[model samples]
Target: MRGSFLYIFGGIMDYRKTVIDKLKEVDSIKDIDIESILEIPKDSSMGDFSFPCFRLASVFRKSPDAIANEIAAVIKTDLNIKKIEVVKGYLNFFINKSKMMEETFEKIFSLKERYGFSYIGEKKNVIVEFSSPNIAKPFHIGHLCSTVIGNSLANIYEALGYHVIKVNHLGDWGTQFGKLMVAYENWGDDEKLKEEPIKELLRIYVKFHDEAEENPSLEEQARYRFKLLEDGCEKETQLWEYFRTMSLKEFEKIYRRLNISFDSYAGEQFYSDKMPEVISLLEEKGLLVDSQNAKVVNLDDYDMPPCLIVKSDGASIYATRDIAAAIYRVRNYHFDKNLYIVGTPQALHFKQFFKVLELMGYPWSSDCRHIGFGLVKFKDKKLATRKGDVINLEEVLDESVARTLDIMKQSASEVDDYTKTSEIVGIGAIIFTFLKKTRERDLIFSWEDTLNFEGETGPYVQYSYSRAKSILRKANFNENTPYDCDYLKEEVEIDLLSKLSKFGEMILEAAKRDEPSVIARYAVNISQTFNSFYNANRVIVEDKNVMNARLNLVYAFSIVIKNALALLGIEVVEIM
Candidate 1:
């Protein structure tokens, strides 16, 4: 709405609508809106915004390059447009430099720390189910992906004005608890159990599997004990609750270290009693079929396996519980979207459940999504929980923090609080390393690659934030003051401002796709860009106006980078 400039991303119905309206002069491009075809030029040389004319080419009966050139000629030079060009069938438009700096810096300086905030999802409620570690199990590196990714998504959705229900869907149900009880009864020690519950519990659970291999009858005993627990046998129920309590206490330590908070601790058990309602609904919808003495929803017509709802003995399985949970969540939270942060192995399972929901006549079933991430392998080998081959999450965190401390001691970056910054940097390094890749892509765990601070890692971004703060602190000017935007017209300065300008749009895109990697990549890029700008131009110059503008850029970079890092669940320290 500023009279002097056309704000690109932040402005509503401005330059984009203008371009779309002008492109309507070509009758072939009528149906396309700016959202559908607008893309940032992959190379900056291609210009600020690009519109590919390939789709319109077939209708226009001309080559895309020719159409692009015609469209470029059609768009007149306005106050907002510096020029338009045709680059290989893409209509790329460049904005006036002075206007870009003024709009970007002014918006960033005005928004300050709230640079990435948006109200796009104001009325929507999103339920994010993640970090569902099984009760009485040691927190392992296997659980890291879900915890960090899910928490980041929750933060991202909240940042975009969605009321996020951060649900820690603890895996506290199933026959596993029965097996844990059997192991605890046979090999458990009281004092050791109280001192190191999950470890001790895990030790005995592994022993049960080891012994069960020899004495196969122990497996039957485990199943029978599980049955009793399900039947609400008093002692079994009490033991299960005790294990859950002790395990939660241990898990809380890790959650606190990561600063993750959950709005709901409801696990599978919360929906245990509610499954019959789902089963009854399936029957009402004529979806329940008797297959091999089990209640199932026949999905063979859809080229999927039959979704078993109930066993021959009338016991429900995972799909049944999930069905009940979905119904419960919809009726309870009335969520616009339900996200399941799980491993890729369960893709079929989620698809099966979601299909069943559709068959049961839930119109909002399409809103459910499984944010499946690839498994984390140790030395390229899969880890087993029952076999005790997993790496304890606590151990990983402690070791990473210790390594961070050692690195800090060797470096000359004057960190004020070594202990606090080490924890932040170490945890951030691990999180950044995990998030740097696409969520759906499998990441190989390597200590050297993950902990490297020099590369595009969390520590690198954190260091950028710290460096920005340090630069601003040297001026003793934490307060924002209006400056002549014309002073920041250098190439690197404009590049930094352009990156800062796209921060909000990136957050919105990430939230829409449920991919935090977009913001993660953006954080690394902005950090690199700011570093380049710092190397090219000195911020502490003698010219007061130029110096203030540079300092504002530094402060803006620090705040935007910090905000992006926070969305990814990474914290920035004053120094590193």
Candidate 2:
């Protein structure tokens, strides 16, 4: 049974190809789209794989049940299958389990860290634009969803062999900077700025709003300053440049804690010069319409807000800059797909902008997508920066780390590098909390929910990985340890294998849908499955062969879980 596993495994590895090949043998229905008809049965007892015959009923001029019966009878002789059965209108296949275990485990151990990844996506490029925080502003809690989701999507794409360009489209330009500059001039203090850059900036921003309520003319002055900066005035440009630099330095600390990196920091400011070419293109294409002396793209037909190109005072808005940025990215990166990871509130904004691109007759406008995520609220109240009801991301991370340290001390835990481990678990908790939900749903971050150790939080998954690592260390598990795939017939072992087998499929789905929750939830499943397997089976058993096989299974699970966590932008600590 063990020796015959490989021959059977090789045949079933490409189940669709094998099934299609077998269907081709029946001369009466040779042109079947068998791939579309295949399905994974909800009940494992039904079969390993199944194909529905509803569509083929019309082609074969027979009932679905009859077509399934005929196809099942012809496919049974294939070496990969143990048996084929027609139940109702579906053809079900039962792949040999021993063979599956051997091929999967052996390949898993051989490939080790690179198990689920493949080169099927070679030569494709993806540009993931995410976590784009506004310059001179605090990295607030609201920015959490986009930051981690975008990073994880980039990782998922890369894992599937796409050359992913992680672009941080920083919010570094616009009329707002003029207000910031005016605020700094009125209340600028070098010592305060050096001590707390983003906080001081936010302080002045709030101050600007407060004062501007009484001093209505202040808005005009701010816009005038912005025009000066846009005109490349030495003093204004230098001030704006200083703000951008200082804000980035502060953001770097948070990015370091989250372990996220970006390939490009080309923000709205980077496209300042490029906007002219876009404006020229829009004008040349006769898409730019003047409404109330402001340049706009009339898109009432798309049921979206008009894409504002230029203000009445001749200043460019977000839509105008984005148009320039999108065209520049297509010309520069030649991306297979360009994603904008923004909030759901901006759905209309992106639609308007993308519609303008479509109106310009750019064929690749279809390749650009807006991956909109919902907002994060606190205490069931809406969070708005203008209201000053915001929690800084850096401060939240610091508090999480401190909380993690307290938990460790309270539990009297024994883990290496308390400082490093605390940061890992704390940041992991934050990242996991954000990624664990569907991007389109609103999340309220509760202290109890984020730090829960026994639940589906990041700590739970990290703890599982840590548990697997500890077991492997205790068993002195070796890569070359000889083991038999036959010894792993336990229900727990098969359950664990079932979870590990879906790693590749999970990644592909996550990338395709631009959703990180798929991988986040799947990681939790693998972790829970490993814990169940650990309790039911003993790895340091008396039987050396069974022990080796179980240990290898443990090692394989650890790799898959670690890979999953990494994709979610969560770090895995050896012990929690």
lDDT of 2 by residue, 1-576 (tens): 322322332323455456556766776667766556677889877887888888878877999999888766665554566778888998888766666677678667767777677665579889999999999887876567888999999988998888999999999998889999999999878798988998899889889988999998889999999999999999999999899999999999888878889999999999998888888999999988999999998888877777789999998888888888888889888999999999999888888888888899988899999998888866523223344576667667888899898887777557878899989998889888898989999987776778876788988899889889998888888788887878998977977886687677787778778999999999988888888888887889999889988988898898889889888888788876
How much is 34 displaced in model 2, in angstroms?
3.1
The runs of at least 3 residues in candidate 2 whose Cα sits more than 4 Å from the true structure, single-residue gaps closed, are: 1-13, 23-32, 53-71, 86-90, 379-387
Q: What is candidate 2's CA lDDT for residue 108?
A: 72
CA lDDT scores, all candidates in order: 0.84, 0.83
Residue 22 miss distance in model 1 (angstroms): 3.2
- Window of ten residues with lowest summed lDDT in model 1: 1-10
Residue 262, model 1, lDDT: 93
Candidate 1 residue runs with Cα over 4 Å from true position: 1-13, 25-38, 51-74, 86-90, 378-387
Give the alpha carbon lDDT tens digit for every residue of 1-576 in model 1: 222223334542255566666666666566666457887778878877789888877777999999888767666867777789988898898777677667777777677777768766788999999999988887776578999999999999998788999998888888788788888899988799899998888889889999999998888888888888778899999999999999999999999999999999999888888877888899998999898889999998899999999987677689999999999999999999999999888999999999999988899899999998987765523222334466767767787799899999999988789999999999988888788889888888766766785788887888888889999889887665657778987888888887787787788778878898999999999999999999888999999999998898898888899899999999999898
